[model samples]
Target: MHGPEPGPGEGMGRAVLRGGSVLAAGTLVERLARFARNVVLARIIAPDQFGLMAIVLAAIALFEALTEVGVSQAVIQNRRGHTPEFLNVAWWINVVRGVAIFAIAAPLSPLIADFYGEPALGPVLAVAFSTMVFTGLMSPKVYALQRQFRFGASVAITQGSGLLGTALTLVLGVLWQNVWALVLGTVFEAFVRFVLSFLLCPIRPTFRIDRESWRDLFAFTKGMFGLAFMTFVVAQADVFVLGRLVSAETLGLYAMAVTLAMFPLTLFSKVVQPLVVPILAAFQDTPDALRATYLRLERLIWLFGLPMAATMAVAAAPLLTLVYGPPYAAAAAPFAVIGVYTVVYMASMVSFSVYLAMARPELQRSFTLLRALLLVVSIYPLSLTYGPVGASSAMLGALVLAMVLQVANLRRIIGLRARAYLGTLGGGLVAAALVGALTAALGLLNLPVLTLAGLSVVPLLAVWGLLLFRERHEVRALRRRGGGAAASDR
Candidate 1:
């Protein structure tokens, strides 16, 4: 039921503030733990082995995307989504989707292996893909919690399970010293999430189906399924192209580089989605408020994302060498390119939550379709010629194009002011360029790895200082305009 619009004093705003902070902290912890695990594993395992694991992960992700029904989204959006009947139907759909993905993908593992020319991938894909089945059985009540904006339990469960899973990977990587360590960690993580899903959410879903609920969910999911495919292409097409055209060692290096390059974007999404998505959904009917919040978030994300993107782009080689050791140094070039791609992509993704909140999946779907088409035309030839660097460049160019289209659409639909939006983006570009130049000069000084990494933060710190100054000026303007301006800004 749509309740009365809750004000800041009524706890909704406080809940969002509190939950967003917790999710941010939790995501940071989880990412740090995973990063440490990867650093350790990279030392123990061969680049080629990591490459094989990357392919396995990509394949599993492909199947998961193919079978996505957007059940959580359906439950979150539907009127009676929290009821047992609706929850049960959604749960059952997830269960079936999971099984179907495994069934279909497992048999085709050999084909993927053959296509990639990695024989071991056949069995590896079958084993790794079983995580889908475990994930499929996760409780639908998790969505109920999300719909209610009660993120504490969800954050606790996910972060705790993620840490445990990362620990397991470290242990297994030390003992096994190969790709299976990563595979088992993936499976363990899924199983833990599946178990925690029920434990954290008290609403037990029974084995029952409701046709009406299913129809409602399907109504949302039918379009989402298509969007999922396009999303997959936008996300993993580079990996797919690189997997085919490059050596396993090269693919592995690219994977690690991309992982580091994507860290800020990943962290941004992990923190933002659980908080912002529900908030947007609640205010969807209030277009003015929604647009204001969306704009605020877009600016906030750019302010935060650009500095990190700049750091990664400029410091890719030293950062990779310092983290994963000298063996993976070749990944630096592509990593730098993809680092810029991520910030722009991150800016575009902020709008995605708005699309979902407004129930306009087709906007994002069209964006992703354009991106996928650009990739389809560009990735193969690029990968064929220039390998990972060309592939990364292509991905960057495609997103930039699609982002322009998306911005125009948002302006038409939401009265998005070009000057208002582009100001932050233009500022970000300036900050990123400054950071890049500073870090590059530092690199030329032949500093030690630890010194280089530490000194690289100097540029980022300068960016933050400038941002803080700008924020102060904005705050003063808001204060001078009186309480109503401050209220609107918030």
Candidate 2:
């Protein structure tokens, strides 16, 4: 008799590499779209508008995170057959949650306007809030696509729709000349994603809910809710503190710095995290398999993660001046601090996924809560004193501490040594430091932007190339094993 069919995680190591390739390609295109939009947006909109929107978005993000309920993760991690009744329950629950968010946000818009002294915020937030409903309507079939590693179609639907939406925003922003363009663009993007997800994925929702079906899933969802809530706080705490304590102008500067710092992390993490969860979850029962997978992922993350952070930190001045203009040059300082923090943040993200995959969701929530508390308590006083700079520095300190704690916790749980963890990260730090020092030395001579940009890449590329060469054997071995070769490597 034939055994069970191959599950999503059975060959997840290879599948992750494939998924990462698709994600990377999509990320490159998305990065281009974002770069073009920001270049135009920086010129058209004032920093205050970004700051105002940032505050409103933070609150909205909290709501969205809570609404996740980890249903998708629960479905993915469930090794048993996909039951129609369970999916139906999740669908209805999401719809109800979306409606609740819209209702709450609608009445609360006035409060947000009052807090920010921006009367326009009330309507802007109302329009933006509609996205939650559309996002909720997306079929769980999308996750099925992810589970099967059918990412090419998913990437096209997601990135292509986003590109179109961004293009619309650009045209509208130029015509309308304010935040309405951004609000509309966002709403349009969500609507497009919802429609496309259903169209591209084949699963249909049935209107059947079985209480027995949900019994096995509810605990996982509860754990994820706590994890999501705490993650939201940690992610947005700095922005919230800055908006409340600092001037709008200062908050705007901080917002810009944050956007710059987060772009790389967002791009890379999007590629890694999705793949990590499924891959690690596949090997959950085998400690050796999980540990090996984690190490490989850690190395892969640092290879790109470190250089991106380094390049941003080293080239912050030129990059900001080129993209945003000289008036926003103050963003450079905070960008450097936050860029380094992002490197540590990315590592912590890996640990977070590992814990989730191992079904130790409480550990994930505990770490998130600890990080959030540290971030809030530290940034508040710093924002009060030194303004955005102090707040950025405080956040950097907290991120480093959080990463250390996360690694320590992972070590305790997995019984791994710290030396191996540090080994993965140490080379990247040394390379980044060298590049930064070289960039500083070169800056003393007052080079032109073109010259500076060209010159700056030399040290970075050299360091990066050397590191790749140093790991050449392992890279080859990984490729020989199930992992598909990266485009660049191929």
Candidate 3:
């Protein structure tokens, strides 16, 4: 079953590097396609179209939060995760939750539309939310692929769906020039992923709901649902509060600001996170190895994320002007503020992944609940006073608050000292600060806008590159440790 004993040149290090590379390349292509679609659609459609779609998406998020059973996560965490009976029951539960969410959301669509006072959204929400049905039916066996380190095929299938959805959305946006473009794109994304799961995944989950499966499923779901609820609150609270506080155009601008500000974080979660969870799970029995892996990934994530966040913050005004044009200029301030939030959010997220890897979802629930509570208290007044800027500031506050809690938990759960996290993250902080300071200093001089931007970005990227090169040995050591453990484990 296993390949020949890895030679000196090959081991866990090579395995991880190869898998990580596959994930990175696939994620990059997927993100580029999606980003290009967003850019073109932003240019084609009015800002208000994004605003209306935001409302629909928020409603869908609410239903998902309420119904999340942690089925996918259960599969990832449970020992018998790959068994046919286990997978089949989880698949059925997922399908049921999807149907239940649609059933609950359908009648409430009118209420949500009325809440936003956008009558046109009622029909669109109903139609768009039906995609969850397809999503619910997606094969649970996909998690097994990641678990087995067959990521190349997994990435291909997943990214293929993303590419298809992006192209479909682009076509609709260019032709229809309406909100339906986003609606169609999202629905297509769900549909395509569902179809691909069946084609690509090795296992086929037939209809079943055994008692053993339910027990395993509920054991994970209980805490997961709480985390999902709090996550929904934390994620959507801004839009919910802003929808009431500001005009649709203003809300659209704020949404775009948050999107661009958190671009790197979003991508990390999409690409890098899938790798971290399964890899860390392999090190669950070895404390030193787990910690080493955690620290390495935390640094690796920030190595890339911090500078990107800083660049977004520094070039906010110009980037907005250049990318989405002049109409979005007001978003520049909020973009800068939310950019700071991205740094904190990404850090806390890495720690949270540790909890998930260790099978302690309750810790994650606690962090999410704490952040949600803080956001609930602050988002209203902050949005009232500072508008998008205030909302972004409030988000940063919640991330900081939750990070402190997460650090304390990590200390207790894994016996990791606060100093270790600080030490690991220090390099990224220094590099990002250097990049930010350089960009800020350069901005003081009077020069052509494009030339100034180019001058600021070109050198700092090289600095980031050099830092990454210096860390090469550290990365190799971490991977070797992780790979050795994973190989022995197999």
Point to the candidate with the largest TM-score. 3
Among all candidates shown, the one with the greatest lDDT: 1
Q: How well does each candidate superpose onto the true structure, as a TM-score?
A: 0.92, 0.91, 0.94
Candidate number with the higher TM-score (2 or 3)? 3
Model 1 reaches what TM-score against the true structure?
0.92
**Per-prediction tally of clashes:** 0, 0, 0
Candidate 3 residues 90-169, lDDT tens each? 88888888998888888788888888888888889999889889889888888755665556766767888889988998
Candidate 1 backbone collisions, by pair: none
lDDT sort, best first = 1, 3, 2
The weakest ten consecutive residues by lDDT in model 3 span 1-10
Query: Model 1 segments beyond 4 Å from truth?
Result: 1-10, 465-490
* lDDT (tens digit, per residue) of candidate 2 on 79-117: 431456666666677778888999888788888878867
Tens-digit lDDT string for candidate 1 (1-490): 2322223333565555566677888889999999888898888898888889888888888888877767888877665777788888888888989998888889998999999999989988888989999988988777766665566777877887899889998999999999889988888999998888878765556666788987888788876878887888888898898898888999998898888788877887788766666666765666676677677667766775787788887888778888899877788889889888988887787788788777666668888899999999999998899999999999999999998888778887677777767866766677778887888899899988878987887889988887887777553332232222223212
With candidate 3 superimposed using the best TM-score fit, by how many Å does residue 150's alpha carbon deviate from the native?
A: 1.4
**lDDT per model vs. reference:** 0.79, 0.72, 0.79
